[model samples]
Target: MSASSDRLPLIRLEALPAEVLVDLAAGRQPASLGRRCEEGALPPPEVAGRALRLLASGVAERWSLPYAMIDERGAIVGACGFKGAPCLGLVEIGYGVAPLRRGRGIAAAAVRLLLEEAVIRGGAHRVLARINPDNAASSRVADKLGFVRGEVALDDDGEPLAQWLWPPSTDFAHDGEAP
Candidate 1:
């Protein structure tokens, strides 16, 4: 494994720091960052708190791993990681990079790292994601990660949404191996 993968670069949900948790709960991070981390444009402590609770309860196998794009000085760029249990044969990968970090391929890198973790530590058999059809960048991230169309669901607004899936046996271009 690469040194980056050796450290298991992705932070586990239980390991999130209190300050970072507070920032996430306080709406301090940008919506774009929060969206990638929490799947919404707005920061809602109740929502984050609830998600964290689920993670703690093991109802959700994993949670957001916030990563800085370049270094400590980088803006709270975004978070990427898996959700659900590997033993369940289902692991969903999601991510959001700060708008400022867009076009830099940071989200793709983060997802690749997470997929490696899922394979190495979690024994994940499959991975999944859902994206808004209109978010071209997100769709691209999924595609670059080797995700393919899986299913469609209707949002609360009755808009059609796309679901993407990745087989753990499939090869990832960035990692150069099956996730």
Candidate 2:
């Protein structure tokens, strides 16, 4: 069922354990969230599976860890985070929203939070949002955040994807961060 949502105050980035990730991936209401899953809050199997791989292969550091996107009402509406800790001062980011939660500025806001976290922790000098060429929505989110285009590269499975880079000096009109 669809739960109440406001575009909203701001989403909290909660660090979840691997077990909880598994639970969310399987469409279960993970106890860590302290609330029931919204209609599309749970991550699909594929997304959660990728996160597991990243966590294991990247030896997730605080800056590169996965996070649950908890809305103001405490329901998780998305999953967002870095692919792994920074390497050579660069890190990749990814985010996904629930079906019912898309088009509400949630992804953009989640991305902003990820960028802020990376900056705050001082673990990454450059943040990259690598997205499939066809993913226009993600491209818009990156653009909204002031990301500039970079060279395209293949992912782990050799799929070519566009790279959007966030320079260290990003201002992004940060008068207020809640989007």
Best by TM-score: 2
What TM-score should be assigned to candidate 2?
0.75
Local distance difference test, per candidate?
Answer: 0.55, 0.72
lDDT of candidate 1 over 1-179, digit per residue (tens): 11133422322222344455556677676434322342332224644564566556766334443333332332334555454455466677666665655676666766776677677676777777778888899899888778876456786789877777776233343433323
Colliding residue pairs in candidate 2 = none
The candidate that wins on lDDT is 2
Q: Distance from true position, residue 6, model 2, in Å?
A: 13
lDDT, residue 73, candidate 1 = 37
Per-candidate count of clashing residue pairs (backbone under 3 Å):
1, 0
Off-target runs (Cα >4 Å) in candidate 1 are: 1-15, 26-47, 59-75, 155-159, 168-179
What's the CA error at residue 27 for candidate 2, in Å? 7.9
